[model samples]
Target chain A: MKTTDNASASLAEQSNDEYSVRITGFWSGRSELIVPALVFILAGFLTYGTATMKVMGTSVPGPQFFPTIVCVLLFLMAIIHTIQILRTRRFPHEDSEGQNADFSTDLLSDLADTENEAIYVPTARPSVTGKRKAYSDWKTLGMVAGAVAAFILALPVLGWILSAAGLFWVVCRALGSKRPLFDLSVAILFSSAIQLAFNAGLGLNLPSGFLEGLI
Target chain B: MESLSLLMEGFSQALTPMNLLWVVIGAVLGTAVGVLPGLGSAMAVALLLPITFSLEPTAAFIMFAGVYFGGLFGDSTSGILLNTPGNSSAIASTFEGHRMALDGRAAKALATAAMGAFIGGLIATTVVVFFAPVLVKMATAFGPAEYFALAVFAFLAISSVVSDSVVKGLMSLGLGLVLALVGVDGPSGTARYTLGMPELFDGMSIVVITVGLLALGEVLHIASRIHRDETAVRVESKGRPRLDLSDIRRAMPAWLRGTAFGVPFGVIPAGGSEVPTFMAYGLEKKLAARNGDTDFGTTGSIRGVAAPEAAANATAGTAMGALLALGLPTSATAAIMLAAFQQYGMQPGPLLFERSGPMVWTLLASLFIGLVILLVLNMQFAVLWAKLLLIPRHYLYAGITVLSVLGVYAISSSIVDLWILLGVGLLGFMMRRYKFPLAPVLIAVILGPLAETELRRALTVSQGDLSILIDSPVTIVLYGLLAITLVITGIQHLRHSKTARSQALKFDTDKLGV
Candidate 1:
């Protein structure tokens, strides 16, 4: 029972870190300080915007009333968040969980061990010599975002089906699908099916673009 | 009695074969979307809002009602099998539902969740049927000041109470309100932050914001990590799916208790299903201790799953009542539904029933129908949904990406909206990556406009008297609740920090072999 409890606890931890970007150095946790800083900058911008808004009436609340209030609130909250982040250990690396030094352990192993009691028993790895941060797969995130951008750029010229098919392939490749042939087939079939349903069946006009005359 | 007769008439209208088919379609679609991680009823409703524009209000709302309940039902399936509860409401179920799956009682756990949801949802809908009129009557008495105060109360409650860090939550709330302020002010006719765009004249599209933040953001988040690990498998259980007599006996009272936790929260703008679910789980845990049952927090507890599932569905049901009766949206899903009501060019306050009586009653009746359909579908096909977890993560997320793009593009048929979707999706990704809560942002966006309008109207009525905000009894009561909430949260925070300190000390001692 203790083992199960600990294993489940670790599973919760794993899930929490599922999409987190890893960092190194003694200031690893300090990366969290960036969000509060960004929020503070945004609050300043809102404040400036509110201050410049022309008030139409003298008696009633102006258009800037709510925005100004929210801006001030955000400014104060961001400051408080900064203070809190500074006071506490800000990074996952600083956590006392036994595996902080070894960032190369396969995530799938952690998942497979979710069902096993052995996960509760932490294995000690030698403290690493250099700063080895296993940041979340940013390359895939970039590729996916790029794919969406490409779709946006392509849609007006290439139309819905073609752009959407291209999007599907790009996303599939980013998600680590190994078979390009299968990916192409799936993307074509899926986009065409959507075209048939929404465009043909629902009578909604999807942008035909260059395919306006083609099948 | 009048309500009962009206409800019966509503049943007559809704029970037609055509509406039944709509309900079936909605339930199936809602369940399919809801089973996917990171997509809840809010996203489902938002993505489908364009359809509402083309359909009759009654049929559109019936479909939405099905989606609402079906989302809650389907969320627990993924929570049980995949350990990924998409929404806060499903978090409590993960506590013991996943444990039960690991304990080889997956079928029993699923049954408990399904039946509990049905009982709680049915009872809560009955509450709505009886109490909506009363709520409508009460809502009629609310002045602008009272409305403003209620919005403030909601904003404060969600920002300070829902999340671990009050600062982060308030930041999220602030950002949402800022987003809400982007369009031309409805009263003043001045553009606040349109950045010289005609599309910005109408403000950000809620559907675009919602689909981008939730659906696309989630897809991006998952894509970032999908290649690092293989997809996890669903836990297999040995027993038949049917709940035994003993199981039902244990779950029945807990279901009622969970409903008790949920009903009052429905009235309050305390955000979403998360609070009631945690409350139910805690209550059941204490009850288990009282009953000398030590199985909780370890292997599994049936009441653990039953109570939270009931609480979640009960909250979903009563939230609809509040939305329909008072025009208050307490959760993200309800907020989207509120947006839907707005899309129909109707405000859902005291005058809604009077202005659209038939539509409102039919919607209520369809909710009941949706509930029954959800129960049947969930019970019979839950195992089939567990199979959904077996789909490769890449394909699942790739499909979501397509859906997000399609939904956004379909709504406005504009590339500009797609651009907004991508930008907001990235913002959502960053927010999630930073552990900032998303619900506060959503709630603020939905409620911010109302808050501003009501405040301005109140001040205008009083000719700039600040005391007008406190003049009414309703406003006073709401402010009082806000104060009490703050005090309680402060105490809780203090207690939590103390416990954490002690735990840290114990850890230090253990490290030193003390």
Candidate 2:
């Protein structure tokens, strides 16, 4: 449904101006490098950390030995993984499979469970691409993350029942619950039920927070 | 004879009302976890670890046994009903199980799976009762060098064999080893990589690592794909899940064969039940083809569901044997179980059989009891369990998220654990997104310190001579096996990828021909 002329015009501009292109809505083709980079930096930190550790005795293998081996392995493995990502041409811009570049083609899902099947036959594009939506629901993800953060911060003060109820309600809303009023009630009922079960059956003390006297 | 008598005593202890109640609770909880997508028994055990502080060690372990086996049984329920295998072990069964459901024989497929699991678990546990003592004897002869080599073998086997890409697997393992280094070193009094935080000095808790990686990580992964992925349709199961005469006859033989295939892999630490289940499925498919049984890849065959289901539970049962005898965890669930044992201040090794004879036997006995209970639950209530999938997606995940946080917080009442849980949860989500295997990271976290401690001890004993690592016959044989296994598995991996590549080529070429 995209015009090739417009896509090509943007493509030309993209080549001239150095900018990041998303491989998929969920993941960028270039973002695969992050794990290797993180691993490399961790190895660097560990190497420095190992260097500072004083060997308590004249022991042959000190506390640093295992850590040194671990960091080295991390470094080597990171290098290998980076090389792998570099070798795989994620953007087969002119590949034989599909001459037309479909912006909405989710490469990850396409490759998944079809290792033994050819890359999408050019004939199959309309069916696959038509049904799919641009994924990576970052809004829902943000809501979930925010709810967890709020719950953790407020747990001690608001008490387990109230905070947990709040968390459940927000997460339900984030996950696509339309009825907030109904969701909150269900959340509170379940959360308080959990509190009573633990308090009565297990005798494990959860923080009562401000509800200490009331509960 | 001795173990049999000991097992009888175990039955007596396990048969008590209180212990039986705990077993029921564990089984029910474990089955619910196993049936739920994106959750595993390892996470259930991790969540349960905190409340165990108030539990008797015997009751706790009996419950852990129930949870472990219950997970294997319940994993396949989702596979048959929804084509979404709850665990990796259930993947192979989904090939035929879901097809059978689609063919309007859902009850038969479910029955076949339950029977397969029952027979496999029974035979495997029987083997474990007799065989674990011999394993413990062999374990007694193992010195520090042997244990270190075993851990290395575990690390190598898990990393290389389980994942599609070896590099990512090792990267996951490296992440775990780095975390393992956070606490005070055992050989030397040096605190390492702790970043000078007092909380980090105790290192990462196994419970936190497991829950974050397996549970919360899954929630985030689901979040990212919530809009894109459509909900899977439930194959409405009709009729009572009881096999007719013909169905039973076909499944009985396949179950035995699958158990045979599974028994050996259960002892090896090459990840979890996935491999054996896959292999068993492949074998059954080949055999069915040879026999001119045209049911596969279409309406599905009952034997197809039976074989993989058997292999999965058999692998799980014998994994418990390995955990008890050698203190070696052959799977992620077993690894968490080892952590559970440590929580009770009990180390499961050669000495555990002698010292905690009653506890070990009771756990083993309860497994048999739990297996019977599971057989009933899965067969009769097959449709009932399938109804769990209908609990609306938002509510299921939201509840899991809260439970993950609540479980971790309840353990220590520490805000620091919650913070670590959050960070690890993010890492877990990323790892899942990138397709790095989660089990190796878990296996490495639990086994890293043990491996390191043994390595140091061996070197100290040998006065820093590297030759001592391969000096003993056991150590030499273990390394030899490791070398041979790596070479063979490497060849197999190359062959598999080549086939995959060529098959893709053929599919494209055939489309052109048409």
lDDT of 2 at A165: 96
DockQ of each: 0.27, 0.28
Error of 2 at B496 (Å): 5.4
Instruction: Write the residue-wise lDDT of candidate 2 on A2-51 in tens digits.
Output: 22333333444545321112232223344678889888888999899888
- Among the numbered candidates, top TM-score falls to 2
Instruction: lDDT for model 2, please.
Output: 0.79
Q: How far is candidate 2 from the true structure (C-alpha RMSD, Å)?
A: 6.3
Tens digit of per-residue lDDT, candidate 1, span B344-370 = 889998899999998899989998999
Model no. 2, DockQ:
0.28
Question: Per-model C-alpha lDDT, please?
Answer: 0.78, 0.79
lDDT of 2 by residue, B277-318 (tens): 777877887888799998986899998899889998899889
Best-performing candidate as measured by DockQ: 2
